[model samples]
Target: MTLSPLTSPLLEGVTHGFFTRAGGASTGIYEGLNCGTGSSDQREVVAMNRARVADIMGVEALAGVHQVHSATAIVVEDVAARPRADALVTDRPGVALTILTADCQPVLFADRAAGVIGAAHAGWKGALDGVLEATLDAMEGLGADRGRVRAVIGPSISQRAYEVGQEFLDRFLDAESDNGRFFANGVDGKYQFDLTGFGLARLRAAGVAEAEWTGHCTYTDAERFYSYRRATHRGEADYGRLIAAIRL
Candidate 1:
């Protein structure tokens, strides 16, 4: 099957994609385009999957970070060593910046007029710690205007599936009491947190030109995306990762 990547009109004129798990050479639990080299899937298979993605993006290779779930954002000149960071920014054409995630927000950033692009892997911890803002700052450092940068968050777990504890709620509340609005009461002591909502809020708070989530729930769409929480619930050994990329 050919790869069908989701695109946002907000990022028009930019070569970017929110790729799903629809086409690849993997099997069993890692079926479809599992591009994560860190996954337990065969190394060669993962390489092949990544090559397919790079080919579709019209790049020789994909550049990415180690994604430590921090707010660190690095500028990429070439696909050299993978640093321990969560976001990557680049102004160089033909260099596709990629991020891998399983339920976490796969955010793509671009300031087409400035020729700068970025990709970030934002989990709850990373989001709360300002990964999105860090991405914009990095892009700005590359001469991209934050006011002209458009950010699009790809498929991620929705509030309906994101049950959280009081501690999780407290973390956001401690950040700002207004964060309480992102949570909805759930059964028992659980609260359903709106991660995408929080992400967009952060982006807007940081003054991005525009921001939007694709609104596809990773946990709810097993056929189209991968979800770490879903795999954990099913008692699976591991899960595949979905890839999102953007290029100038």
Candidate 2:
């Protein structure tokens, strides 16, 4: 199968993509392009999938982090180092930074004029801790202007499918009282949290030039995406990860 990656018009002229699980060499639960080296999928098959992505991105190798769900964003100078972080940024022309996620926000950032690109895996924990802002800070260190940075959040769990407890709602409310706006009433004392909306709010507040979500829900769309929550609901042993990448 040919790789079908979703592109953002806001990131036009940049070599970047939000790759779906449509094409690759995995089977069983990971039937499509499961690029996660950390997954239970066969290492060689995952490598083949990643190679396909790298080929399409016009790079020899893809650079990514270990994704520990932290706010730390590091500057990538080595493709082999899988540091324990959640975001990566680079000014090097050929380096393509990538991030893996199931339902969490996979955000790609680019400041075309400065030739800097960034990729972040922003789960709820990382986002609340400031991964998006940290990415912009890392880009700025590479001479990229935050005002010129354009961020596009790829497919993630939508509010309609993200039900949470009062404690989850309280976490965001505790961060800022205004965060209540991102939640809506759900069944039996639950709240539907808007992950992408919160991500866009954080990016916009961080002063990025433009920020938008692809608006694809991972939980609802089984044919095109992999969702952690959905897998757990079905009692599946593991889930495939979706990859999103950007290059300078």
The numbered model that scores best in lDDT is 2
> Which window of 10 residues has the lowest lDDT sum in candidate 2?
19-28
Give Cα distance to truth, residue 68, candidate 2, Å.
0.7
What lDDT tens digits, residue by residue, belong to model 1 across residues 46-96? 999999999999988899999888999999865966999999999898899
- Write the residue-wise lDDT of candidate 2 on 1-248 in tens digits: 89999999999999999999898889999999999898999999999999999999999999999989999999997998999999999999989899999999999999999999999999999999999999999999999999999999999999999999999999999999999999999999999999999999999999999999999999999999999999999999999999999987
TM per candidate comes to 0.99, 0.99
Quantify all predictions' global Cα lDDT against the true fold.
Answer: 0.94, 0.95
The clash numbers for all candidates, in the given order, read: 0, 0
List per-candidate RMSD values in Å: 0.7, 0.6
Off by over 4 Å in 2: none
